[model samples]
Target: MIGVSHIVVDWGTSSFRLWALDRAGAVLAERRSAQGLAASAAEGFETVLETHLAALAIPEGVPVMMCGMVGSRAGWVEAAYVDTPAGLDRLTEKAALVPSARRPVRILPGIAQRGAQGSDVMRGEETQLLPLIREGFAGLACLPGTHSKWVRVEEGKVSGFATFMTGELFHLLRSASIVAPAVDGAATVDPRSEAFARGVGDGLAAPDMLGSELFRLRAAWLLEGAGPDAALARLSGLLLGAEFAGAARFGGRGPVALIASGPAAALYRAALAQAGVATVTTHDAEDCVRAGLHAAAVSAFRLERMSA
Candidate 1:
């Protein structure tokens, strides 16, 4: 067991998830907080960790490995994004193993994709996908979130991926947009509505027209006298439906797996079902960043042994 303690931290934009693990990857103690990167920008990063760790009573001298925005350019340390088609070692090569009095710390790097056309990067979801790596699944893995990702995993290695700003758009439109003025903040999913299904159908049919169509949610309500409730449902449908349609383009005919374990995962499941696409969803399970950290840790340990 190395006779030493280890802590895996998945600190994202909005929340922090920490797990104290044994040598066998078993979680010994777990803690969570609202002190995410976005929240801690005003306060220093180390203060956020100190406050949470003090609450968790985490003793000193625990080896800690972190994933997510904690390694972003604006996070705790600036970690470079590892290019696609790269292995764990390549990603970790750019990670800075910070000196600490408590224990050795390692931060997982985000993944980046660029071309003559443009570029995109993921701060956290890449870590989650690392745990999903295995043989025989030569298709795409969809991780739905503020920025949903469609990762192409071929023969257990990541080939490429695309990120869509679906979640952020949904949040902005639902609350900030004027289309659904009275849209309830605590609305629930209504799977039976044709409005929702219509949004999905239209989105799947023409995802490229998404920019123009988003206006329909409000126009359908304000101009056509649609209800707030209906507009809300349609808003959710448009995004999830668009994601389903856009993500499907990556895998083509092969099977697709949704790896996220949260509310967004549930919405995606329902959307895929409405689309008649066979799908599976996982909930309240391993966090993506933690899974990615574990994967990176194993790879690091293997490399360390190999070098020895």
Candidate 2:
């Protein structure tokens, strides 16, 4: 409260994280909650935002900067997408303003690929691309999540990108499809599991045979009594493998980089290794998002410089 310069937020579909920071980006205070876009939509976006603001004792005049689904068309404000082959700087310039708030609030814009052949849109993940551009990162970057995004950066701009529903598909298949019984009581997926490796091989080897491979996991449970752990790992590997299979064909200009913060880091790393991609540089997901959010804050607001 005393020395805070601005507040930065990462408001995703099911999670909310806010930080009070000085001009130098050192966090002064922090808050995290389950009041993501969905919960905030029902509870009232401003109301949800205010509750946290008040809890943090965030003073009036401290502008708030946000990224993620909070800026989605279905969230607080529709922070339109900046089409591909665009500079990352467009994110800060095109940020949408949130109206009628206690203080100035803005949400960063997402990126869109409008090509007739491979049209796609992504929100929230673009913030993760800022650091890459800032560092002169040129090549492909794989950011894994519910909807994993593989982006191509060239000449300090996002040239092209692709998205995969690997996580969502894995969840749907395990809970709602015929593969439920096979993974119902499954233990955590072992990165080094033999079944996992086999599944990865199965996917990369036969991309067109994915449906059959998924069904085979269930069949293994029925006849050979394949355990839950193996079943889950096998399924995860299959999905990730297929995702990479398609992504690999996206045409690479340089080595791959994996930006992840959680278990996804290891999972994606292992999957990449299995797919014969062994020269990836790994960056911490938190670092990239924080850098991106701060950069957006700087661009959208005239951040006050702290005194020496």
Candidate 3:
């Protein structure tokens, strides 16, 4: 309570990101590493974290707020899940405290969607949605990742949502499946390429044939010597296309608030255009994460007063 500072962390399954913020919630220093939740579990979460903290010269008593898989059953602590219709208050209220840390450390819980839709869970992404909550956004949102999420929000609270494993499938099919041959060593899927568009159209038109469509990637390569670029593009397009089709029901909710960074955003935008998404609102993923964490810091720590 006395450090008058905040260390906000987005500790994910495959990567770790931390931001050091001063009293006003402005970032003072930041770091990112491959020491993700799973990796940190082996290296010791405290050991990895304290190393970064020491490098940043963060003074003692600084409270740390974290979100993501770090709070998962396998990570640092099982922070539990906050059910759907969750809001800012619920997140702060349910934050799990880590008594073993040398400093005050709390990890925010993930959001869970249950029942007929199939049991679905999202961790770090829930924090990224906080900016929308701040703006009282009422609409659908697409958060793309290994396990992509299509979220529905009424004002600030999440109403319902769905997940798509588009990225995961793309990786698996390209790396491990029999379909790997066609796309192996292929160039990265070009967002604007004809193959990308065609694949998207094919997926959008006939999601039922995804299995067959994926197989065609190899068959085409073997038969016509179709290049890997096309193969890779078509593969990505098909997977993302299927994802779009799956989330098509929510498209009518309004323009989707797309929160993604770098290539993912570009790929989604291209696919959205092909998917007939007329209007798209994009938010910088980093900006949203920072704002969301700042909000959490305020709600959980009354951050400014402490820093003052």
Candidate 4:
């Protein structure tokens, strides 16, 4: 146990989740709100949080730590990236703890890195990856989110990761792209056919053709006369398949841990199976974040207390 007061915040672009934990990192109270980085833009961050904290009746001066897109350029403040292959020790910053009657609040900095090919960065996912990597296999952790991350773990530390906007791209193609217009209003999806596997196979063969692959969906409808739902599943299959292939190169026959749930996990499972790679999935989203935050908080508190 670090101390009596415990607070953890996973503030992102779309939503904000706060947890009040006991010294042992057990949740006492938790709340979720729409006051994400985007929502707070108009009123500013402090106001966004004040409203939520007031409603929760949280005391002041509680030690608080945060993760997520809230640390991005569009977020309250730029926390900077800790780079890939990083560990809990790389997390730095005692962000101006929001002042309150009970405690101080601080935001942790994300991570960033640059190499010859290019530079990559992350905001909050690092927090979630921390404990997961430490708990299971310690080498090369892949986290699938809106921006799927291929993180390299060395000695139980997050060394670095690359983020591909796979999920968002899937949404855009399905909702806005011409190739996926047929699937815009889909209600259900069926991935139990050869078409699904075919898309996966094609996508893996040419991962970079994702943008152009949308044309296949449209062509399938016009030429092959495929249905809307089938087209949607095909597109989904293509994206997942490509990502799986690209990410597999990083796995290096090493164990890979997937941290996600719902339908997304299923799709990933199918793709991995098709590719003949073994993986493990943890379904609890909040639990993953909590475990991550627990590791982060423990490390930070120790470092802070040590220097003190």
TM-score of each: 0.85, 0.95, 0.96, 0.86
| Candidate 2, lDDT over the whole model | 0.84
- lDDT of the candidates, in the order given: 0.70, 0.84, 0.87, 0.70
For every model shown, the clashing-pair count is 2, 0, 0, 20
Model 1 CA lDDT for position 178: 64
Candidate 2 root-mean-square deviation in Å: 1.8
* Top lDDT model: 3
Candidate 3's displacement at residue 193, Å, is 0.3
Error of 1 at 122 (Å): 1.3
What are the per-residue Cα lDDT tens digits for candidate 3 across 58-127? 8877888999899999999889999988888898889999989998899999999888767988998889
**Candidates arranged by TM-score, highest first:** 3, 2, 4, 1
lDDT of 1 by residue, 1-308 (tens): 23324667888888888876656566666888788887877787767776666676776655567888888878877778887775555665666575542446678788887784248787777677666663245566777788888778766666788888888988887777765474555366575677678788878888887777778766665677767667777777888788877677675224567776656666777677777776543423365556567656655544334223
Model 3, residue 210: distance off in Å is 0.5
Which 10 consecutive positions of candidate 2 have the poorest summed lDDT?
299-308
lDDT of 2 by residue, 1-308 (tens): 68888888899999998888888788888889998777799999888888888898888878888889988878888889999887877889998898877788999988899866389878877788888788888888888999999888899998788899998999899999999999999877888888888888887777788999899989999999988899999999888878878887775323688889888888878878777785458988877887788888877786754233
How far is each candidate from the true structure, as Cα RMSD in Å?
3.5, 1.8, 1.9, 3.6
Point out where model 2 deviates above 4 Å. Answer: 252-254, 305-308
